[model samples]
Target: MNIRTMPVVAVLAFAASCSAFAADSIKIGVSGPYTGGSSPMGASMRDGVRLAAAEINAKGGILGRKIELVERDDQAQNDRGVQVAQELINKEHVVATVGYINTGVSLASQRFYEEARIPVINNVSTGSLVTKQFLPPEFPDNYIFRNAANDTIQSAMIVREAIDVNKYTKVAILADSTNYGQLGREDLEKALAAKNIKPVAVEKFNVKDVDMTAQLLKAKEAGAQAILTYAIGPELAQIANGMEKLGWKVPMIGSWTLSMANFIDNAGKNGEGARMPQTFIQEPNTPKRKAFIAAYQQAYNPPNGRIPSPVSAAQGYDSMYILAAAIKQAGDTDGVKIRQALENLQEKVDGVVTTYDHPYTHDDHEAITMNMVVMGQVKDGHVVYANAADKANAVREKASGKAKK
Candidate 1:
């Protein structure tokens, strides 16, 4: 869909930006799956990046150079992501990059950026190893950074939600065979072990697998009180639907992917009560969130006015600002300088997800922490705060300058 409307203020600001933009613009790469099952997260992330770029460009961009986004669809494949990374780095000559929806894609691809000394901000991919690909004693500097909540945080939250919150002692783990799923599954196991518990049943499936009957039957036979998941949207929906077919329903607690629109719509009533940790729910709790939601609605005019992946969009939006802040602080588009600026950002970023204050450092490239996430549950086709207390806490956090939008 076309942009429904552009705010008059933005129109004027963008018009002013035109003259400030030189013929050579600051190239930033946007790489993700714009098609296929993972499209919801990828597309939402791209849209958020687009929104942020527009706003930045409207304000005459960073360092008085218009921000130019070079987008490519990796189709959620590892090899494709590698190729996309190389193209962006070598061919397009992008100073920095953002957007990696799949953990496998980020793992397979981000090495190129490290080798080239180009900064790559992972806005969606949450694999714990993503930012640790290069460390001291081996690689002098790291170029890979992330704004998404890593699997370590998610697995802990999932286990806590199932065991501590819901009181489910016997939980089943259903994870896809992909790197994202397997790595997350391992993290879940560790989290469970920490709680002095083991999964009643562990099941694995492929990417496009539709029938989860075998997995569900095994979980049911094992007397699992809940199903912990580690997969993307469509397959997660299959698990919910599979339970429906078996006439047995158990609470589904998993990663942020459970908030995907595909699962919510595909699972329908069956998807209700599913909970996951979210960096940004689609609620207009803070001023930044309200403006972001309204801007997204006006720009893309998405179906149902619901972002396919709220977490993806918010993180992607924030990633752009983070990169821009670094660029502005450095006063140059040099990759190495940009990376250094990212590690020690003097300016606090006012973003849709949260207010970033010293979000990164030389030893830590992860921008998100456990406190930044909250449990969100599916309710009548939308993700809402699982606990009323979380909603209040979120608002309070925003007011306190720790969170917003």
Candidate 2:
């Protein structure tokens, strides 16, 4: 070849090599309780995130680069959550953040991200504190976004379902002392008043408490015909068992987190006949759900190939997809830009739980809604759709006339 042709070929070869060698991996930080008391819920978060990262990478990834999830075990502690988030933001230098099931941990760590200007794509923390920036004069331009349903919105739906749908005259509120449980109780009260109904009792318990007999007895004495609660992991099972042991057979409601497999396996038959609002439930036959279930089974199933908490896996999967979508939309991995893209997500996200339509916005930080939270009852050791739930939803809509548009 001529010298001129050789130079041109070398330039083209160099450019091609650079293109091929250009790394496309963008790191996203995932923190949850991989150990300690909240491990079941944390495992779900971790599994879901891994599956999502895998799916995105398999599909050519975001911006021709693969997505990498930097996972850490927070052990469900506020201090640990904060420390892990710092490592992700500073040491790992991830483009964005996700995970953290406990609100206390999420709240504790949010300030750091806000100051660092790194966006947090929160999947599990439901405390209104995440939106503390959006309140009044403190409106933040960008910082936090959530894919999971918030307690206020979910609890309001629970109360509406119980009073308007279930037609229960008297209800009880049983919640842990944490922000999640307390907010759930408060929202239920407001929803009750809005519908001209009242809860017969509102009781509180700690996260470590195993015996809720006294609390259940108090609620029963107050003429509570139905129970609505917000407690994570095995605590929820303990409450269900306590209620059944006391022979209270009324309809019960709680957070979608109760759908975790551990809660059902621990509560066993007692968990049956109980109802909880959920954003995603494994359906009959869908490619997405099937793939997720299959992956989880391969990783964590027993000799019988039985899996415990599929909900956690589903959440982790969906959260990662949502984060990837935001990153793709941004066309760059800057945390602030990604956060904006998430808030302005206008397209439909085919999540493991459901198809999210215009799920987030500047006006609303909480994405999932009552439509996302379908009421499911434990029947024959599986969570099945409650009978006539659609009819009840129609009644709720007619009664409330559409939640302020």
lDDT of each: 0.89, 0.71
Q: Tens-digit lDDT track for model 2 on 1-405?
A: 211122323323422343243345677788888886678778767766765665565567789986666778888888998899889888988888888788888888877887787777678777656666545456456577776767776777788778877788888888889877787777778878998887788889998889999988988898888888887867888888898788776666877766766677788888877777665565534565666666655444533443445566676777777777787788898877877887787566777766655666766666656555567677767766665554233211101225522
Best by lDDT: 1
Per-residue accuracy of model 1 over 117-184 as CA lDDT, tens digit each: 99999999998899998999899899999998899999999999999978988999999999999999
Error of 1 at 270 (Å): 0.7
Segments of candidate 1 deviating more than 4 angstroms: 1-23, 395-405
Model 2 segments beyond 4 Å from truth?
A: 1-24, 132-136, 302-307, 346-348, 388-405
TM-score of each model, in listed order: 0.94, 0.84
- At residue 293, candidate 2 shows an lDDT of 68
Return the top candidate by TM-score: 1
